[model samples]
Target: MIGQVKKMIKQCFFSQNNIKYVDYKDLDLIKKFLNPHARIMSRKKTAVGARSQRQLAEAIKRARFMGLLPYLSR
Candidate 1:
């Protein structure tokens, strides 16, 4: 017989600290929400609320425009 295990999603960054803003300058933090391919993680995957997800998307775009984050991997 075999048993199945379930993994729980972690709390969102903003939610955990009650952060109201997602800054583009925080590359280290933002990058965590992006996959190795450079695509944004979905709300379901990040376990973030709708509002925070939108904020995160906007921040990522800003960072990309400023050349802080790569749009895609080579």
Candidate 2:
């Protein structure tokens, strides 16, 4: 294993998809960042950048406020 070179892969979804804006109405995308408990996942867990993570959090909060997404899991 001494000669093995670890490959670092970027797993940022927004970067891969070229999404500049995070939309609260996009349940599919927003749901990906939420855990079963309806909490926002951490940046390390989601592999999202700092800025994108903030945007995601804001969108999720907005969604919850608008009753589009649940505040807590059932």
Candidate 3:
């Protein structure tokens, strides 16, 4: 479940954008952009940190999208 949510968030925000900065207000839009699974994960993970999640999510998304992980080739 968590993995699916992470994937959805990646597909929505990371896949589409090349920018680093995201507005707090824009979080709603980004939330809508994520898949249902990701929505759940986002909600659950919200308590982890306010701004850090966005940054971490963005980084993970970017990394996955770029095919930078060696194991991803498999």
Please tell me which predicted candidate would have the highest lDDT against the true structure: 2
Off-target runs (Cα >4 Å) in candidate 1 are 1-10
| lDDT at 62, model 1 | 99
- Tens digit per residue, CA lDDT, model 3, 1-74: 77666533423333355545654345454454345544224635433343545665564465445543221221
Off by over 4 Å in 2: 5-8
If both were scored by lDDT, which would come out higher, candidate 1 or candidate 3? 1
Better of 1 and 3 by TM-score: 1
Q: lDDT for every model?
A: 0.89, 0.92, 0.45
Worst 10 residues of 3 by lDDT: 65-74
TM-score of each predicted structure versus truth: 0.82, 0.89, 0.31
Cα lDDT tens digits for candidate 1, 1-44? 24576667688778898989999998988998999899999987
Q: Pick the candidate with the highest TM-score.
A: 2
TM-score of 2: 0.89
